[model samples]
Target: MSRRVFFVTCPKGVEYLLADEIQAFGLELVRHSPAGVWAEGDLAAGYRTCLWSRLANRVILHVAEVDAANENALYEGVLGVDWSSHIPGRGSFRVTFLGQNQAIRNTQFGAQRVKDGIVDSFRAAGAQRPSVAPKSPDVAVSARLHRNRLSLGIDLSGHSLHMRGYRTEKGIAPLKENLAAALLYRAGWPEIAAAGGDFVDPMCGSGTLLIEAAMMALDIAPGRRQDGFGFEKWLGHQPEIWLELKQEAERRAHEGKRARVPTFAGFDQDSRVIATAWKNIARAGLEGIVHVEVRPVESFTRGEKWSQRGLVLTNPPYGERLSERRELSTLYEALGETVKSAVPGWRMAVFTGAPEFGKSIGLRSFKQYKLFNGKLPAQLLLFEVDEANAMTPRDPDRSGEIRPRIANEERASMLRNRLKKNLKTLGQWARKQGIGCYRVYDADMPEYALAIDLYEGRVHVQEYAAPKTVDERAARERLAEALAVIPEVLGIDPADLICKQRQRQAGTQQYEKQSATGEFMTVHEYGCALRVNLKDYLDTGLFLDHRPVRYWIQTHAKGQRFLNLFCYTGAASVHAAVGGASRSLSLDMSKTYVNWARENLALNGADSGKHRVEQADCLAWLAEKPSPDQRYDLIFMDPPTFSNSARMQGVLDIQKDHATLIRQAMRRLTSDGLLIFSNNFRRFRLDETLQSEFSVEEVSKSTIDRDFQRNPKIHRCWHIRHLS
Candidate 1:
């Protein structure tokens, strides 16, 4: 039995674990690299490792090492190897080249050179040349070049050992099999399993963790279910040794199945993933050994039939958006409470990309391991669910209680008092007027510079960006205090409060998405139902300041053909259609807003052939000569203060281009039609020449509603008419 050098690859942080695993397989460790380890093992040892390794990605038999300073040297070095001794002359092979050098900048070219070398070697010996197969082939070759040295090897584990041959379907953002196995090992699952401790995943996605845990408990080889390996077709493969290892693995698996392994259960809120999980468990041949259910974390309770002490392992969502992150805090808190009340004496391990969220779990972590979920840095926080670290279940009646205290109680109290007074006045007035959305507070106190609006029952808070003189830390503390105070004073759930930072935006920044939650709610204003998304954008779909303007359009739109330019979400178009406008056309450059407008109209039962929403740049659309039928009796032009949107034909500065915009829009208006032009530029002034050319009246005062009286300059509006 000649000792052969083999290189094993695993995830980045699992190199040491893989080293230990290789040593446990009776293979001598030779060297360690970043994501791979070299070990000295014979053919049988290599075969056993491939059959048993739970954390390895690939097992490569190191055949040759050569200098590869240049492409020509790389080719010649590979050609020196005796091709006939390894792959057969008629066998097809695939080259998986990794790394780059000054001479071989492209990995494909490097692989091509390697392939050419082997083919030429076979031809030089007057033997049939081997063909290349990009997919599965008779033999798979591994070529790694680093620091002008290349290591060539034969890949023994086909298609990565992580496949495991069971998980054909996976949930969104599933953990790779090897990574899941490493997490189980780090959480001390083996010892717990040996003691007959049960295993559960409260937020199992496709049951990867549960399946992996069951396999570990039953001493089942990770690759036992695999169909084939890369070396099966190699000329030098020892079928007898491979057969012996496979049979031993099968025997161990068969015996371990009846060896009194502890219970393994999984639960997920998503029913789709739970179905996929059942399929995966069945495929892994652990249908009876592992159990899964479509249940949420909050519904998870310790099973009566399971052991008293077990491991509660789960991978909860690490939110990628601000709103999701905010919502996940409550989820983590609920998870903490559920685990403490359900499995008090068990151990809990949480794997998350956002470790800060782990703090919300409210349990003291006894151990923490820094790892990676693919390229994202992640951590495994292990907690003992005993009395010392357990959290008391939250009171259902006080679920909305603000948990964090305000840093400055006096300032927060002042803000709270002000909010109460405004709500008393504005809330009463909004109800009287049948308005479902209104601004309750607008930076009335300079220290707490926030604009808080109430839409239906949800609160949308926008913190105005603090001035340069304000300390960043102080501003943050004040914002936090405001957030803590708002929910308390408004008597609303903290989860219903969506907060955002308000800053001066340019070049369509205001329209850019802040999150992808896609949560939209309907609110009523002036007998019209409007759709608003409080989380996804800086400005909710319906601008609260534009309330009176939309109403004004509704009042005067009867029997008119309406045109809404820079239409945004088309709240005004909806208003016009609802107000009995004969026909309406709404134009905006954003397809998202166009679809939203259509939805808004559909929601209000106003989406008819008479009402149309088109996605077009307002400026470009205004410049085009309108057909006679395109002329409208009532036209509303509310352009952004400044826009350099890529979809637009050119830059739009309200101050510089207002006159041109008004003229172009006027060209599409009937001789007796009215153009209601508006903008939110605080320093805007009507073009003097336009006032002289047309009958223009500044309706800013009347357009500013009572909710916006504090900031009367929120927007400027005008009714432009042609002098007949």
Candidate 2:
């Protein structure tokens, strides 16, 4: 307790905030560095910081600082640290070196030098040398080398503080426990907790945000459940001081009043994540405080009894690099809409790494906090959503009179810059190749740009956005200007370019439309279409992202009977029949799509003798036909993410029923047959334990279309080889 101790504090930026926090505990900050804040405090105060500092990465107690310019100096300096007092005679220790100076070029070599110094010191003292523990150590010694000065310290927190022990199950893309807590803290949850506002994470993945919020609301020390602290093993360990800190933390928890522990609720589209969130809630012992449900954002109407002032914190998908931002654009916009319509008085906090992606939500962030997830710098964007609009009593006559505000024009300018570069490079090649049709580019989210396809020297653009929302028509006009510039900039005839808008569909609408060139292609409920060129759209000739599995079927379908389920335009079956399949049956409940599939077969010169396209409910079709005599040899199964068409026997959930579908498909497959099942669900996880019945090899690469390279997980295909 008498020794001069340096406290090393690592926080996720906002050092002044942490310094202020330390100062609040009566510890004056001695110095500050990039890695942490340096303060002179006794062993007791160091332990206190580990327990209370909400933003610190970990706390370390300095053992020694010495002038160690060379290898010998480094060794001698480390040996002089008096390790016997900190670590017991022969206790295990790990030396982690953060190198910033000339003495050490490599971190490992520096660490080794420190290790040698400690070992040699013990040996010279006639005491046994302790072994090295890398993963976890009885004692953690950190060595920072800068300008020939060696600063060594003992890590008190042991493990990274991010592992808060609450999350028992990991959903797809679950936020790291520590990062989640940091996000909550960064979003000003502490103030919200003190103010009496509730917290809700509608897109909760494993209840991270909800649990973190609950801990904040209840004044629960995140480290309360932690079993050990590094100071316990130090030579000057003070049991009474540590106990007092813990008791004080407990006292605060008991004394904190949250206006009746404001209601915390989490909702997810996936039942699995909901179940995982439930387990996590229980693991955190917060089952009574936190509630989670399986519900889509669209179906999530605010609970009638809940307060309107709660904070809405969520980490919705950025779609990552795996998904096309275009595919999830509407979802993001819909979420923004939901927040504006459903939760009228709530504030919103969203954390995402993609800047372009943040714009996709349409709601401008009031403040953007820079935080990190491991090495990736992320922005915690805060939105002061005026749910006043949602709660407003609608005037039957005046409700439609409110004019919508324009989206940030700056973002559009940024998009224009990016499109300029892309067009400057790819436009000329497209026109010269007679590729009048192609996907101009895909929008990230919320922007909802028209999918431009050039057909017969004219642009067929599909404007996919809500009707009369903002300056959507203005965006279309900007796109038209962009399309017009493409031909001239690329040295193509300006007369060859024209623009037309493809109307947006609601629900399960389908239609065939002729463009300016009179070429007809089928369109589905989504803005996605089956076109034959590269100039007018972001994609042409069907979504090629599904190419790999389609080709997988073509290669395996020769002379084999095939069944293409969820056969959108029967693209896969056409590939199969073209590959000389003996017979192919395409099943889709959409009659328009069934006819489209037949047209595709005709376009490919496929004969009707071997091809049969049927409009039937896939699930019901499978149920009615029990025998395997007329079973398929090659089955192509691709399902919608979530669908509840009246033609179906029941609502289809791809994630929940994939195992059953795979099992059923396997039942109809020949001994050596291949069943290719796929889904476009971005975060789809296969039933590994269930799929074990069949040899399932992922054929994602084989099924990817060349045009869809930007979006790898546009669909994921698995090749099921029936157990022979």
Candidate 3:
């Protein structure tokens, strides 16, 4: 039992956590590294680390550390090791080399050289030369060459500790076992479990955390369930000691499981994954102990058996695997709601790569840890689920509570300068074009996420919701600064500056009115008067982005019959009527917007009998078979990204139903008619079925103004017409 050093490999960013874990296990941690940690320990200490340390990816007993600056030095260094003591005579072995220097090059070449050195060492000795086994080998040798220094060790754990030998099936983007354990450890789950506390993972996919929690609760050694380790094939292996350690662990596991183990449960929205979780649970040998069921986060209310004021932990999926990343925004928020409503007063830890999504979860996380899930960087959002923290002015993300900066600080000054620069340039361009409404600042600085548009004398500031990675506090502060600075930069009164947080909206929610102030302000756009309300809604009366499209409609509206469908506030209809359209029909489901459109028309002096506004489901109106005389020469159809209003028949997925909606509009078109179809769904694809029946062309690029240049797909516009 000579004094020896060990190199324990762990995931990046958790080096300190691993160092603390090794120290807590009574092993003397010598130093820390980015990839792993260096520690002083004997054979038992190394063995114990493999048996107990959960944060470690692999426990490597330090065999040698040498300066292998060149390939010759590397060969000699590895050959110097007593290969006979570790690698058996001519037995199968795998060499895994990590990191690289200028001399060693790629991992494959380094691995080859290490293997050759091991074989040449054996040949130089009387022992049999070892053969290479890439997949599974008798012994696993870990090697590293960084800064011309080589550190080598025999991997005591056969597999990376994350394997745990229970997960036969995994859900999409499953959290690795060690990382899951690290999250739990960081959240102080072990202490909670030790004190007979309960465990819960509401969005537990495939039950990794629940199984890990159960193992921790029942004092089950992770290696106890594993098949084998690298030491099993090593010549210096002590079978009796290994057997004794495992047997002791097995005894503790049986006793703990048989006796009072903390109550734990897992829940998932998908029943199939719940079954997978159950199978995973059974494989982890916690079949009867941990309960799992199919339940959404919204239903994760307090339960009698499992809700004993313990940690409600989960790694809810974020934007990575999902095609529509925006959809995850609501999912994270629902989990937060579940915590606030169901598990109040309990401890909560939400591990998500996208932390901005956590904002929707409403409950503010007091502490956050930077951790990695494989290669993806993530955060473990820790919150003390106190009901008092759920809703209050103190809630960090609540609109009322702000950390405003008023242009004095350097960062604030930098933002103000950028805004001033944009305003001077785009502002002059707007005045030259006789454009009363235009963008001044479009997130020119990353810190400032506000989209500032100058509407006549008023300023409309829409703050883009911060991503999960940005600290909520940082987002709030930047938002506050933007809110404070926009009016001053625009030379507008602070009262005239309207601020709104723009979040990801789905279906009709995007078009859904934010308020009912019924307030209106008359604004001039390209000489045509329009009514815009800076308050009471996400959008002002005029969509500044679609200024060019409205102008295009107005220029082409003279003496032509116009039809506006799903027309919100009838800005386009008003523009067309002002352009002298012979007749126009404005159709909308919301009577409020129809009334608003009427006001916009009246403000422009185009509220005449020739222009009519109708409050009806636009989809139903389009469905009706119109008389031949009802055909229009010009149609303006801008449908919502999605809609399921009770007034409508079914959900309107713009991407899915665009063809039907377009064809229906074309059905009421004159023999040679033009339909301007547009939508704000960024992912919307125009249907090609009508390409044969109509001349379809996306005029989005030409119609997009300077204000919306950052996102060209802000709203896609197409000039479609009957081929005839």
Candidate 4:
């Protein structure tokens, strides 16, 4: 009957929400800490919390607080507790020790000490010692140590409250039930449900959000479906009080089913997850209350019979991998469009680990909350689908002009003018030369530092990394301005634009994929067809600046045995093979690129036994002595400026290792064979000592095509040939 202190724990960001829930249940608030809250409550209060609190992970009944300066003190402090009153004779128990200090560095050690203390206390009293049970113990004790002080308690909530005994099947990354409830609370779902509003999740993986929302709307006690609580077996547990609480919860749940509940619906692209969601929904006794289907976000549509006002809540993929991140951007954009068109005037909340992708949605979020999805930091973005927050509709007449939505009109005009001028000049040249892909602008103006390239009808923009001295905010705003102007000036849809930050790449970073869309488009260069993926890598499959070099190889490769080293996607090899090379071999360390090269060759009808594509470290492969059959009449070596690939034998610094690489390649070259070596290292200086060793000539000026005339230093090339 006396008031006892209790500690309630929840997820990191759900402390405040849990505290509010505790107070709603008539428990007096004592204090709050990170991930937990202390409350003053009696046995009945604890029972009610365990039965009704939706956001709590566990409820612990505080027993005592004692000084624990060291291991000895920790053991004595735990031993001083009256274990006989809580643990029954012959009952199995477990100790959960949390936090660490210099005295007790390991949680396992602390738990062992606590167990020893409890066993010794029971033995000293001539009582049967309770057995230790790691799983489903009769008594679960919690010992928390902080600042040399220990607080020991009896856990009353067995097995986290998040396990509602319904979600037997889950997706790859299932959101916890408690966290899903917290998101609903933050998104104002309770109030919306009270007003008879509906709920929808377009990308719902396993329907966690939908189930949680349905429970809230129907007033179903979250703990009603729980198997049992930790307090059920404790000797001090009052069976009458616990029975009354459980009976009340059961009555409320029975009544809630008959109450007016809001519509709860979800859709996922994966039918497997949707089937799992249906099983979960059926287990929760909401099979008819909740509806789900296998529908992608693009096909998401509101039901004609559903309420017009509701919340569109979803936890879309966070794109943990770099490739997924780029691909998810378009997915997020589609979600935003779906929300705007399908649920206009409704409220929406998106929980994502990559918050930057929220901008892709085009809708401005009115509120943001920082939360953690497990260990990953995440954000909950709230938006109202009203006109004020609606995305600016693209005007048909102004489609060819920069949108006034950009704040800096003057800067926008400048970028637009520069792009127009470049397009007028280079556009004409590209058409006459039958080039479908080329750079239209390469950071022509310092303020707008972006390389805008056109591949057929699509546009790829690479924003050059700004100097440290430049304000990052200003840089971002300028990049936004450039993005806004480039699409209009190039006469392309904004959806066709793929923007990425271009920084100094090192150690095969450029070769790493930025996305996994696998959406490749074929573009023409010198009448040769090549496939380029604009959404995937930092650099498209085909490098446009190397147009002249590939052309030169095409013109002079007639009847020559060609070799392409560091051949990315085998673009150069495709050119050589098309130019009548008698035979060719392309070598690169990346298996992905090797497969891509084979695909590219097949796309151009160049994949034959005569032209082989092999995956091997060019540096290591070149170190081996080439046989007479392996020698080639002409060789092209374009190694990365710097690569420390684990596949490679050693680090490669183009400036430092070019001589060795060139010499290795020249060994495979015939006496009259020519070796075209090139790199994009701006500050590269060819090894001067090579002049006396071989016939070397700087052909950088001649290799640069018209599209790269403005940036002549984009790459450096050298012609190295064996001297007779």
TM-score of candidate 3 relative to the true fold: 0.64
**What lDDT does each candidate get?**
0.85, 0.67, 0.79, 0.84
Ten contiguous residues with the weakest lDDT in model 3: 318-327
Quote model 2's TM-score.
0.71
Candidate 4 Cα outliers beyond 4 Å, as residue runs: 320-323, 392-499, 502-539, 542-596, 599-724
In Å, residue 235's CA in model 2 sits off its true spot by 4.1
lDDT of 2: 0.67
Taking the tens digit of each residue's C-alpha lDDT, what string does model 1 give over 613-692? 99998887888888989999999998876554446666565666788889999999999999999888655667788878
TM-score of 1: 0.62
Task: Report residue 555 deviation for candidate 2 (angstroms).
Answer: 4.5
Winner by lDDT: 1
Winning model by TM-score = 2
Query: By summed lDDT, which 10 consecutive residues of candidate 4 come out lowest?
Result: 393-402
In model 4, the Cα lDDT at residue 397 comes to: 35
Residue 156's lDDT in candidate 4: 95
| Model 4 TM | 0.63
* Every model's TM-score: 0.62, 0.71, 0.64, 0.63
Model 4: per-residue Cα lDDT over 1-724, one tens digit each: 9999999999998898999999877688899899989999788999898888889999999999978789899888888889999999799999999999888899999899999999998998999999999998999999998979989999999778988889875223448989999999999999988887999999886788999999988888888888889998999899999888888888888888788878898998766578888988999989889999988788898798778789999998643223334545667777888888888879999998768777777788999998988877888999998767766322123324233246689878888888888899999998998889999998789998878899999999876656546786677778778777777888889999888763222223334765689898888888788888898787787878888899999999989999999998999998898899998999998898899888878877875798899999988789899888988998999887655455766555566678888989999999899999998876577777799999998999998889999989888888898877
